[model samples]
Target: MFPYRPMRGLDEGLYCVDGSFGRSPLGRRMTVLVLPSGRLAVHSAIRMEQADMAALDRLGPVGAIIVPNTLHKADAPWYAGRYPDATVLAPRKAVARLARRMRIDGTLEDDWPAELAAALDRLALGGVRMPEAAFCHRATRTLILTDLVFNLGVQFAGLSRLLLKLDDAYGRFGPTRLFRWVVLRNKAALLASLRELEQWDYDRIVMSHGDIVETGGKQLMRGAFASLGL
Candidate 1:
């Protein structure tokens, strides 16, 4: 299992841990951010061994567990089992899917603790067939997204390349056309949300499935949405 480690040159409070999606071979990432109270909020959890758990403990207590991606819930139950007191938050639509396995403390729309609330804001991508929540850190000027935009630029090889191309995602830096076709129900509403996101002052982007954007994230995001003609 990959261990938790601080992301280089990012804000001191932010960290990332890598894991493979179950049986999928592709690497996935989990975002861990330390709140002002020193507690941690984890997004897209992955199973960790004892040593990694200890490492996380050294960082801070696990205070919040967020299942941001509609389909990325493999480790949520494991995290909830390990940190029973941590608040479990997921998108409204995801609640039903996850309720089959674990208890949900709240949906993204609910009020979070003051410490985290002060630093984070959740944006729900409305009018999409699959519900997803995007988060922003006010202090770091960072945006956290899941499946909205991908930066898997030139990483896959051989069969993976062909499959990604078939998936409409090979080496691309934006949402796959197939994904949009399947989930984007109201382009206007999605466009409005993207435009609102453009208004944010984020310079970095941390996405679950791709390389993080280190700078000019706003422009990158704007260009991405514009590419869809939204």
Candidate 2:
């Protein structure tokens, strides 16, 4: 079995899977941010469910659950109504895309405080305008991302296995150069964003469809951007 450690402030803790192909979805460790009051801000919600509500009950309640992005929107809503005061946080653009495919009533973009923006700027993890996106658990040095970069295959199934063979996301780790050129809209700004994010010194990463990088997360991001000629 892979190794896992309970991150004190983060309940339900973090786990990691290691293998030749790197960690797959099944072994990704999500960092759970449990506030003193008992509210929790879980990174990705695959393992979360209605039945698990009782365990989370110890905390006052669940507040502001985040889907992080459209790529990982599938499992978020199952538990939304369970919490009296929680709404899924999704990129404004993704809200429509995901809603069309699922029954989700998520919140639009949130206005972050200037202090938060400045802090990110100081760390070089400045703002990114990727249709609809947000930074999470600033204190954790964590960045929640969607399709801007896919660390794993999309629709990993029978036919998809073959189709993904040539698709940029398959067998590929991190963002492909062509995908970035085609989807980034403006390369100059994206490069600037990467540079800013590099300054933040983040050590962990949470992606919608792949594994969680416990350490060396910043290097993975830096390496991916470097491949794009940034």
Instruction: Name the best candidate (by lDDT).
Output: 1
lDDT of the candidates, in the order given:
0.81, 0.50
Assess candidate 2 and give its TM-score to the true structure: 0.63
Q: Which pairs clash (backbone N, Cα, C closer than 3 Å) in model 2?
A: 123-199, 123-200, 124-196, 124-197, 125-196, 125-197
In candidate 2, stretches whose alpha carbon ends up further than 4 angstroms from where it belongs are: 1-31, 47-50, 58-60, 95-109, 112-139, 153-161, 170-172, 176-178, 227-229
How well is each residue in 94-187 modelled by candidate 2, as lDDT tens digits? 6677677554444433533233343221211223434535354455666655455657735476665655555566655576444555556766
Per-candidate total of colliding backbone pairs: 0, 6
C-alpha RMSD in Å of predicted model 1 compared with the true structure: 2.1
In terms of TM-score, which candidate is strongest? 1
**Candidate 2 at 170: error in angstroms?**
4.1
Which TM-score value belongs to model 1? 0.92
Backbone-clash count (model 1):
0
All candidates: TM-score: 0.92, 0.63
Where's the lowest-lDDT run of ten residues in candidate 2? 13-22
